[model samples]
Target: FRFFRWVWRVTYLTTFGVLGFTAYSIWEARNPADQLEVDQSKKTLVILGTGWGSVSLLKNLDTENYNVIVISPRNYFLFTPLLPSCTTGTIEHRSIMEPIRNILRHKKRAVRFYEAEATKIDYEKKIIYAKDDSDVKGDTMETEVPFDMLVVGVGAENATFGIPGVREHACFLKEVGDAQKIRKQIMDCVETATFKDQSQDEIKRLLHMVVVGGGPTGVEFAGELQDFFQEDLLKWVPQIKDDFHVTLVEALPNVLPMFSKQLIDYTESSFKEEHIEIRTKTMVKNVTDKFIEAEISKPDGTKAIEKIPYGLLVWATGNALRPVVKDLMSQISAQKNARRGLEVNEYLVVNGTENIWAVGDCAVANYAPTAQVAAQEGAFLARLFNTMAKTDAIETEMRELSAKQSSAKAEERTAILNEITERQKQLRRVKQIGPFQYSHQGSLAYIGAEKAVADVSWFSGNIASGGTMTYLFWKSAYLSMCFSTRNRVLVAFDWLKAKFFGRDVSRE
Candidate 1:
């Protein structure tokens, strides 16, 4: 009886504590402290994009060091890794998006945010021209923002490789709208396939889904689509289930080229089990509204042209430099030879530019354009800025002390000299910041049918794992990596809802 009473008391206390914390968090979010007024003397730090790179920098940056302004077309940071799940309704799009305002509110000082696209940068003048592209705008639609230091993290765009009809007929999975469009298209195709008096040939074509590229994004999307077919679509539209087909076409020799050979083999086998066809060494020459023309190479180095019909085509070939990035490159002589993106120095400073730095897909630092790399680079930049700010302060103090020492009495002069010596040491320590370095955290991917693969860096070695256990690891890792508790909770609930009730088949 005593033990039962103790358990009840503990439960009640725990519940109350949780409720109190929740209430406090809500209140704090609603009532943020007024931001410190911008100090005119401080340097203005302008950041572009709200992607992994920019967000990471904002999260770690000391706002007191600079007056920060963020400019991006998007006002929310997307969790790109889970974007594939959104295509099949396994995870809702909103679940993975954390508003930029929500993130900025937690900072010690308020940051200026502009939901506008950076049209051009006047490097010599240290000014950026941004335009409001929204539907409704005020009298001032375009303005010039002056920055003392600028960070360009405007990520890349979808690469179509100049394939014919790709832009008009194919869907690129890069943003929330893309995922929502894919989901709607999938259902539309399924519904059309189920129309009365529909011929078998047309039905077959309508139920066929084709994905271009063999990278992680393409593979993951294929997996999620297959899962949707097997889980929700099969139960909801069983008539077209047997005719559904998914094909992944890659020009390379194999899928998941970045992954280990063993893991790649495992993923292929898993995909085969899920009835997802993988066609390697098949270069797509053209894409039409109804079908795609491809050249399939034989083992004997012979190639045969073939036309394949698809109901829905997802173009995930890769990334390309955005026009803004290309324009910036053209303006900088040192970046003229940069084919992929802007070339940067060891510290991520744009070549031939002292005040401009770049990160993420916009920067060509000889690193793979991955979220992990961008995030690490952002954090490194934050630390570098902090250190630089400290060095500046120390140097200012040292100069003042030196001047005071020259004008002071003997005793005061001795004391000022000692302080100057200490300040010099501090400045030296602050200036010793090394160049940006990246530590690979390894790779992870999900290949349907309750399976996943991971090649993670362990203590002094590598741990390659796959199967259901690895799927759990993948889920936990992504959940923990979510940008905020709100996002994490939403994602968790979505997963649980999908698992329990299955993904919603009702198209919006």
Candidate 2:
């Protein structure tokens, strides 16, 4: 009987030994800790744009986890929120732009940057064809890059529609080049009109400025132009001071459709006070070198056609899909319905492809193409990638232990298996950003000087604030949103200087 009991004990020990060994082996086979090791295998993340969205991603991403590359024609990210101020020299253009290279210096790993425009994206083979301005003029210096992940943050282009002569004569305020052109044109017209030989009608035409589309951009530009005339032109160039005029034309009945009714009234009242003409319900039908033809909706519901001669016409219309994004959509069958931009799923992944992801204005994220949206989306993606890396590590460790179970002791084997299971739960715990939900922080528009409007959240509900206190809040909020502390301090100083003296009149 004693001999039988000894045999049973041996059998029981051996069976459990095999069970533990089997568990370890199976875990190791599946886990492949090395294979699962966060794909640190030189996976390339291609970011396209130096705008707020792409820049925000670059700032937040885990650089050590991937080979990061940024592609954009511009080498710096322009702070566009304060761009209107640049037109009047309230802030130097250079002050609002931070170099892309300087921004990337904060990355854990050096990022590859391309100062070229992406011409085509071959998703079938995962390649991006690009060309620089020098190479775009039928040159043979085009380049191609292969990427594991491609982020399309190319933003949008200015919409000219199909209005005749509009593209040729109207000035757009979408880019830095546009602003510079407008400034130079403004000066050129003023100088030429003030010529001793210029006629009265010609001088009036040269000084007359018409701004189309009363959106935030148009309103802001008009305000800046008025401020320029009131402060600088009136004092510096008094020859054509009486002849100068500024007109804002909007198709909508209200100046600011996005603002509250009270704010809109305030803006209109302010414009009226400044003698700046506000033409609402006015649709520009055609634009000529010296005049603009528009159909005005009258109180009697009749459309009256009128022509207004002007020296400068600024078009601040909204954006349209860029050519690159349009081409990409045509090339991919799954993206056929994506007319606005590349359609993305909840994961920010391209609808058809699993490996590819897109962010920012180029992607149809079901959210407003605002800087705030893109920045948050990019940060979310970075956090997701980081979690993926951790999961891979856990899985790899489990697989490795399973494969070497025969060599590990029973206690060590059991402990390793428990750890792997626990890691799996942690991986599951990582939050995934489903279809994005935008939280409205608030909307603020700078009119001029210390006048602004803001619709912000209050303790009870949303509050519409305007005037001096609102202007102070607007400045503080934008300052805090600046990319760095240095930027915040510089912007603050610029405002102080502008208040104490006046805006600089020098144009670079």
Candidate 3:
């Protein structure tokens, strides 16, 4: 009886605590502290893209130090690691998205956001030409934003490698729209296969799903797709189950080249158990509406061409430079040899440019184009910019003090000199910031069936682990990394909702 009483009291207390915290969060979000209006007198810092790097910089930057302007097509910051799950309804797309307005509202100074795509950057004039690509726009839709400083964080686009019919037929999984298209297409294929008196061959073709690339995006999407069928689709549409199949094609010998060999082997084995066919040493040459032409390498050093039919083809191979980045590169002779991305110095400044910096996949800094690397680069820039602002302020004060010393009395001049010396010391300390250094924390990928693989950097060594536990860790890590507390709560609720009710199969 005493134990039951204790349990009852503890449960109510915990419930009330949760309620109180929730109320406080809601109140705080609704009523943000007033921010200082934008001052045109300050340096104009223009940032492109709403990806990992740009968002990270916005979060850490001292906005009051400069007149900040963010230009991107997207008005929300998306947590992209769980993008794959969106295709199968494991998590809603909006759950991982945080509004740009919400982010800027909490800043010390007002930051402006323009939902426009940066068409080109004029290096000589320090101007960015942008076009409002939204559906609703006024007469004056295009404009130029001039900046004293610029940060190029416009991320890369999907790479087709010049494959024929790829852009027309194959779907690229990179954005929210891409995921929605894939989701709707999956249901469309299932329904089409169930059409009355459908031919066996056509039914098989309609039920087939094909994914290209062996990278994390490809692997994770494939896993989510397979799980979608096994857990939900099979129950409602059992007749099409026997014909349902998934295939992953990769030019390389193995999937997930970035992961450890053991983890790779384990993942391959897991996929085999799930009945997902992996076609390695296969290069896709052409993608048609109903089939793909692939060159298969034989064991005896021979190549054979074969046509593989697919209902849905998802391309997740890799990234390529955007047109804006390409245009900017063409303007600079130093970037001529930069094939992958804009060549950047250790401080992430663009080569041959004094006031321009680059970050994320748009910049080649001898690092992989991943979110982890981009976030670290953005934080480093925030520190660098903050210090530069302080240094400038101190230098201005020193100049004024030196000019006053020429006319001031002897005692007053001595006092001014002492203050000037102290200011100089402070300036030196602020400018002592080192170059950007990226510390690899780790990598994680979910491999379906409640199993995941991770290569984490422990204290003094690396710990590579996989299986169900790692999947939980993957969820927790991503949830914690969400852009806002609201986003974290939404994502957590999404996971719970999916687990209990199964993923939604509705096409939206």
User: TM-score, each model?
Assistant: 0.95, 0.87, 0.96
lDDT of 2 by residue, 1-508 (tens): 9999999999999999978875775554344332112333678889888897788778888777787888999999888888877766777677777889777765667788878899998888899998876444555557998988888889998877788999999999877778877887888888888888899999999999899999989988988889888987888888877899999999889987877899999989888888789999999989999999999999999999999999989998777888888887887789987777889887788888877777777888788777778887777677767766666666777678677765888878887777767766766675342544556676789876468888776765889877878888888888878765456657888878876887665544
lDDT of each: 0.92, 0.81, 0.94
Per-residue error at 412 for model 3, in Å? Answer: 1.1
- TM value for model 2: 0.87
Put the candidates in TM-score order, highest first: 3, 1, 2
- The TM-score that candidate 3 achieves is 0.96
lDDT, candidate 1, 223-328, per-residue tens: 9999999988999888886899999999999999989999999999899888999999999999999999999999999999999999999999889999888888
Q: Lowest summed lDDT over 10 consecutive residues: which window, candidate 1?
A: 32-41
Leading candidate by lDDT = 3
Query: Which pairs of residues collide in candidate 1?
Result: none
lDDT of 1 at 172: 95
Candidate 3 local lDDT, 1-508, one digit each (tens): 9999999999999999988987888788778999999999999999999999999998899999999999999999989998999998999999988889998898999999999999999999999999999999999899999999999999999999999999999988989999989999999999889899999999999999999999999999999999999999998888877999999999999999999999999999999999999999999999999999999999999999999999999999999999999999999999999999999999999999999999999999999999999999999999999999999999999999999999999989889999999998998899999999999999999999899999999987999999999999998898889877788888889989988999887766
**Sorted by lDDT, highest first, which candidate order results?**
3, 1, 2
Cα lDDT over the full model 3: 0.94
